[model samples]
Target: MSTHPTTARPMDGTARAAELTARTAAGAAELTRRTGTAPCLATVLVGEDPASVTYVRMKVRRCELNGIRSRQVVLPAGTTTDRLVEVVSGLSADPEVHGILLQHPVGAHIDERAAFEAIAPGKDVDGVTMHSFAAMGFGLPGFVSCTPGGIMRLLDAYGVDPAGRHAVVVGRSAILGRPAGMLLLARDATVTYCHSRTVDLPARVAEADIVVAAVGRPELIRGEWIKPGAVVVDAGYNPGNVGDVDFAGAAARASLITPVPGGVGPMTVAVLLEQTVRAAAVQLGEDPAALGL
Candidate 1:
């Protein structure tokens, strides 16, 4: 392995996210001017987990910054799966709502998939439904899970081509890991998924040209495993703001790496706002690209 001190360049997501958000804000402003309807995102939080609450608050704040309206529905912890579905379905049917986000990890008794499926496909800007997953996998036009979608955008911003590259994604959760791998695969990257059960995880990771750490285990992917000149996208956000990859260690070998807080996090909200604007434009029969989105 080439051991020259990693010429790793920081992929400054904060700067890129700000640029995208500004673009989205401009598009939203134009759309509102033409249609007299501001783009709106409806957020449904099932319980009051502190982290989830904080995340929702951040999203709402970003919406405000982008000139988008936000509608919040806070449900009790004791809410049943059926009731949760009812609530989300109501938001899905609301004509004024352009995008729907259901905060994840609802009560254990609630059927998460059932609740996610209740969202209308058009309003599934969070990309939790089967339709959205299929759309992303097939490279069709549809909303994507914010984090994965944001990762793709980050790659685009940095001009990293996924075509014919080996990408190893750690973790297989529906929202982050699985979709991330699918999205990379759709872009023609050879993809492999490693979870807690995978054998010889380090060896598998060392073979990758691109590594996406989304397993949510802090420092689970050690620095030694990072290939020289690889691009590392650490998508994990654990307690204490730690990511799955050892930042310092991985950076020593990576050509590009994303920092935990400033990396994938900001991009997620930016993509959500951008997609909400697109959804609104579609609903209004306006071309989002023509609005310079």
Candidate 2:
């Protein structure tokens, strides 16, 4: 390794994710040993959106790597809300399934919240369900939405303290943006959420001590818009895997920044695997191994 210190802190999600997967592997092994059933996540994808397909595949592949089992269920674009709910509800009732992660953008016609509600709260590892949302807002124990959960892990691994900081989260989607803001709030950060309709997006982003780019628009946040030495997190993934922030520009201005492909992406899968293992152990009537803490 080069001895020269990096002027800009590269939040190394690459290395941190390696460590998380290692632990998840062990957890999977222990759960399998005790229950004779591997921990499994049932992924539900509605429609044939290419990005949604890629995301689901990525999650399943990661599950395999971490020694967890994943089951995929695909529905048609024309699938109705009730039909989607039926599939999700069935999966929730399946004892073999420990967790359910339903991908978003389930077509405009489908009632997204209703589909999310079909999964039992305990099996809602993705935290898309109302129960998970309420729990997160209340700072109670529950499965966190995976992306936000991943973001939290990244923050922890980077030693980025959010206490008393201003955290600006762009996007208000249920999974990533909204929950991410709530998480920061729970950590004592004053949080603000901005979206396309926000009057002054640039001003809001520039004000953040911690800027999370969850809005899907590519490079919508400019370099000059960034606060010098602020921490920048690009949670957005557009075509060609580009993130929401202009990486090159943001990286130069940010004291710390997370890269697109390696940063939040890896953590999302890691959180899913972690939650899957935990859900499995709980179903087995055993506490998730927390190093005996």
Best candidate, TM-score: 1
Mind sharing the TM-score for model 2? 0.93
Q: Where is model 2 more than 4 Å wrong at Cα?
A: 1-7, 290-293
lDDT of 2 by residue, 210-241 (tens): 99989899999887787887888989888887
Best by lDDT: 1
Give every collision pair in model 2.
none
Give, for candidate 2, the lowest lDDT window spanning 10 residues: 1-10
* lDDT measured at residue 27 in model 2 versus the true structure, 0 to 100: 83
Stretches of candidate 1 exceeding 4 Å from the true structure: 1-5
lDDT of 1 by residue, 1-293 (tens): 24455768889899999999999999999999999999999999987999899989999999998889999999999999989999999988899999999999888999999999999998888888999999988999999999999999999999999999999999999999999999999999999999999999999999999999999899999999998989999999888989999999999899999998899989998999998999999988999999997
